[model samples]
Each structure stands twice: as structure tokens, then as C-alpha cells.
Target: MAYVPVKGGEAAILNALDLVAEERRGDPADPELTLAQIRTQQARAVDRVMAEGSLYDPDLAALALKQAQGDATEAAFLLRAYRTTLEQFARARPLETDRMAIRRRISACYKDLPGGQVLGPSVDYSHRMLDFDLAGEGAPTAPRAEAPVAAQMPRVPDLVGNEGFMEPSEPPAGDPAPGDLTRDPLAFPAPRDIRLQNLARADEGFLLGLAYSTQRGFGSNHPYAGEIRMGEVPVEVVPEELGFAIEIGEVTLTESQMITSVKGASGENPKFTRGYGLAFGHCERKAMSMALVDRALRADEFAEEPRYPAQDAEFVLYHSDNVESSGFVQHLKLPHYVDFQAELRMLREMRAARRATEQEAAE
Candidate 1:
């Protein structure tokens, strides 16, 4: 069980790293992929990197994607780590979805809403068929109708709020500052704001699994998708010297509004409770899953006891981080000779003891 170091491990590790770099360089003559192409062409991918990273620089996200070899979670971690190095200039004002330049907006609760259903870029209704022509010289496409402006489109939540059909999602009482999960460590019995911030940047796969668990009778609530919208929302920052808020930039965002039934309280009519999700880029699936988990974590607020893993805040939030989970899982690949030797010694001792007992019994 004594320690025995591997000879030439340092040299082998350095050589292995070099081999990995060389392997990443596929055909030498192939055209290099530019950052612009990754930002525009691999837009959805870049969006995912930005969302999960909690940083919105497209160029950095594109670079992270290239460095990570298109692994979304790895790319996000790269960007997330880089963000800690940057200086905090100013915090942006809370986003206003009402002013969003909507590209895609749909409501499941109503067929006819203020702006009608705008089914933007979605393949939900498309047939699953592979095209042979795409492999050959690509074919040209015909021109289509000009896209409508997003400013004119009305939100489904706004319309419902007018008639008081759904409860209003007012800002947290007293306009309190929101928690920054990246800067501060997560603790047990987290606030709703912190829970949401953590979920917003949590791994998409982890959130998806937890959300699916909620639907399959683990912590099931009769849920309905009130609305899901994808569009560009302007970012505003108020500089202390400037004395007023100004638009700094615009970023694409996907917002989900989920409604679920809760038991009526104290002679009041049963009202639809809300679960919300917002993320960078066209991330409908992540957004929806986030909304479901957000609602599930609010069991105590709704006067419902936690009955499942999905509903347990401590369990879900701690294990849902991709970076932490990935690092822990991948770390097993490292040498564990010391630990293995101890196990081997224990096994040998057990076998020798068993043989001595057998010989005594036979005699």
C-alpha cells in the first residue's frame, strides 16, 4: 500500500497534450472557420454558450466553441471562467419583455391573441426526412414574404393580465437587488431569486431530466404553456454620472411562461400559478425546463410539502451544475494508484484469512 510514483509521467502528460492539439487540426488545406461564421451560422450554438456561460459576448462564445470542439457545456465553462476576469462596469436594468422585438410568439392558452400566432423558425411540424440533394451542390431558394416587425406584437401575458385571468408577476417587493450566483456560493434554503439565477445557467441536460421527472408523476402538477416567445430585447445600463438609463446593446432571448393549478386557499378561487424562464438565444427547451423546475422548487411557498427529488431545492441546485458534475466525473480518468493499492491489499488479506479458516475446518 506504500506510494510508488510513475516514472516519466510528466513527459508522457506533455506529449499526450501535444498529440491532442495535433489531432484537433483536421485536414491542413481545409478553409479555416472564422468567428463571424460561427456567430452567424452556428447562431443557436453560440446562443447556448452565451446563455449557459452567463456572458453575452458572441465573439468570446464563438472562440470558446472552437476551443471546446463544439462541446456546448465546455464552451460555456470557458466563457464563465473568463467572465470572472473582466471588471464589473455596471449592472443592466431589468429586461422589459413588453418592448421585445418579437421574432416568434405563440400562445397555447388562446388561438387568437392580439398579434396572432407567429410561428418563427421551428421544425416541430416538419416531416422527418433526409434530403439527398443537400449532400450534392446546394439548391437555391425562392424569396419569401418580408418578416413583420416585432415592436407591434402584443404579449399574451399582457392581454390576460388586462382581464385579470392570470396573476400579475410584479417585481420582487421593494425592488431588491437580485443574487449573483457566479460571485456567491449557493447554500441550502436559497431564495427564489437565487434559485432562478442558478437554474438559468445550470446544465441544459440536468434541467431537462429534472423537469421530465416532474411531469411523470414525481411532482406532477397539471401544467399548461401559457406562452413562449423568442426575440431581441434591448439591454439598458444606468451610469451614475449619466444619471439616466441608456440602451447599451440588444441580445436575443427566449422567454417561457408556464401556468399550473394550485389548491384554493382560504375561501379564494383556485387561481393559475406562474412559473417563468428566460435565457439567451433561441433556447425554448431549456427555458421551458427551467420554468418547470422553478415551480417545483416553490412547494413551500404554495403551502405544498416537498415530496420528490425535483421539489427539493438543496438536492437539485447542488447537483445540477454541469461544470461541477463534468469535472467530478472526468477526474476519475486521473491515476488512482494509491487508492487502488489499498483496495488490493485488503482483498489479499481477506483471501489469506479465508484459506487459513478453511484449512483449520478441514483438519
Candidate 2:
């Protein structure tokens, strides 16, 4: 059977939009969410928006989240689209992660560290249960007693490097001008900077799936969580008139370091390698996934064969953007009457020809 093109009414389309709007604003009696509430209370969601959107304005991110009805990808899309209207004044000075005000810091590769592991606010060990109190007035809980935070913590990679365990003593501080994925069109065999930028904005769920694949032996590299840290980091930008850079503001960030054991390809001594991930907020899951994908996508750079989908840079980068991928998926709903009609006509002709051939054979 051939598919037939169905005609639609514009009135129905307009009514459907109104229904969607009404659905979004269910029960007017319920207290409406304020921008400040979303910004402060839902800080993690806002942070995810900022990180994926590649914009750090908390207030704007909050607004985008509210506008998106708490959909992170939609909020990110809103932020990313709005980011283009603003002028490109100047690029901020490179971040100094060493100076990050450590909040939640931990290591999986080691039992202890120089500064000690701080298990800051985490749901890792929490029981998954829905709180009915949240429907009304929620019960308050006292804050946990925290140990005095260290002024500075040594990076896990640095620790491993001190023990002469890593192939490259320290991760390369590649001082190259960062690529603007928004401005430049992505190309094959992308540079490391561009690849990282894409991963930074890539859909979290997509990245997570890819990362999980590697862990399940699809693209095994023997990864261990070297370190994961979340905290506020000061932003600094240099103006043309001012010779020195000045602090603009501070924003929350999550950084992940993934270490993997590898056999040297050229008969060199086997040593540990690293994959780095950094994002705009307290997003450990995203950061870890980004780190895993970061290493997986670097198969070519490491002279390793692409054994899985995660290792294929082109496959990962091209399909990673949420906005692009989501839009493409949604576009299928739009009317393609002319195109569908042509396809249906072709199918009908082919079917008719096949029937005629059968009748002639019977005769």
C-alpha cells in the first residue's frame, strides 16, 4: 500500500499551539516558578544550560530554563541562539584550574590524597525516593558538618606524574587560540580544541551513552576516574586599553580527569594516559562522560585503530549537537506533501507493473 498525502487545516495547527501553551501552564492556582527561584534553587539545571549553551550568565540561563519549562536541551538551545546576537568583545584569559575554589573534590584511583577527599553535596549514595512533602511544604534538613577546605589541592594527574607513572609527565597545556564552534563550520579530522568545544556543548545523554559503550568493552581503554572536582572559578578578561586582565565574575565549574592504561604502540614503555573534561557548573556526570568521549574520539591521535562508534570522531561530533539533532528529528513532522506524493506515485507504478507481469506469466 502506498502512503497518501493528508491535508491539514491551519486553524487546527493554531489551536494545537494554544493547547500546548495551556498544557505548559497547568493549574494556575499552583505558585508559579520565579526566575530567582530557578536560578538559585535549581542551580544545577541552570549550570547544565550554561555549560552546554557555552554562556555563563546565570540569570539568562535561569530565564532560558524557565522559558524552556525546565527542559535543559531546550534551555541550552535558547541560550546558544541568543548568544549569537551579542557582540564578540574579547576572549577571556585562559582559565587557571589550579586556582579553583574547591568545593566537591574526590579521586577514584587513590584512597587518599594530599588535601584529602571532600565528598561535597552528592546524591551518589542517596536512596531514590519521591518526596510527597515537595508537593506542599518540604521538610528542612540541617547541613552536614564539613571539614575545612584546602586552599589548593594537587591534581591527581600531577600526583601520578610525580610517581613517574604517566607517559606524558604532565597534560600538555596547549596554548592555542580556542576554536569557536558557533562561528566556524566543523570539518573532518578536527583539531583537539574544536573537538573539546563540540563535546562541551554536546547533548549530555548522547555523550553518556557513548561513554557507557566504552566502559562495556566496546572501546575499552581501562579508564579510571583520576579526579573529579566541582567549585567556583573566577573569570578574567583583558581589555585592549588595559594591559592586565581583571576579574569579571565567578562561575561554578566541574572538572574531570580520566586516566587510562595503554600499551605503547612503538615499543615504548607502557604508561598511563589522560583525558580531560571541564564544564560550566557542578555537572560531574556530564564532565565524566565528556572525559570518556574525549579520549575515545582521540583514537586517531593516539595511533589506535577505530574499533567502535565512540572512537570515530566524525560520527561522534557530527551527531552530538542537541539543537541540530533535535531539530532534524522534529522536522519529520512537518508536511512533505509534494515529496510524499511523488514517492507514493512511484510505489504505485512499481506495484502495478509487478501485477501486470504476474498476470502475463499466468496467461
lDDT of 2 by residue, 99-205 (tens): 88898999998897989988898999788998777887667678778677888999998888777777563344766567778899999779888999999888889
Query: Candidate 1's residue-wise lDDT over 98-193, tens digit each?
Result: 788888888888998777888988877798899787787566677587578647676666666677666667777897898888889998779899
Counting clashing residue pairs in each candidate, in order, gives 0, 0
How does each model score on TM-score? Answer: 0.91, 0.91
CA lDDT scores, all candidates in order: 0.85, 0.87
Best by lDDT: 2
Off by over 4 Å in 1: 1-7, 137-145, 150-154, 354-363
Model 1 is weakest, by summed lDDT over 10 consecutive residues, at 1-10
Inter-residue clash pairs, candidate 2: none
Q: Which pairs in model 1 have colliding backbones?
A: none
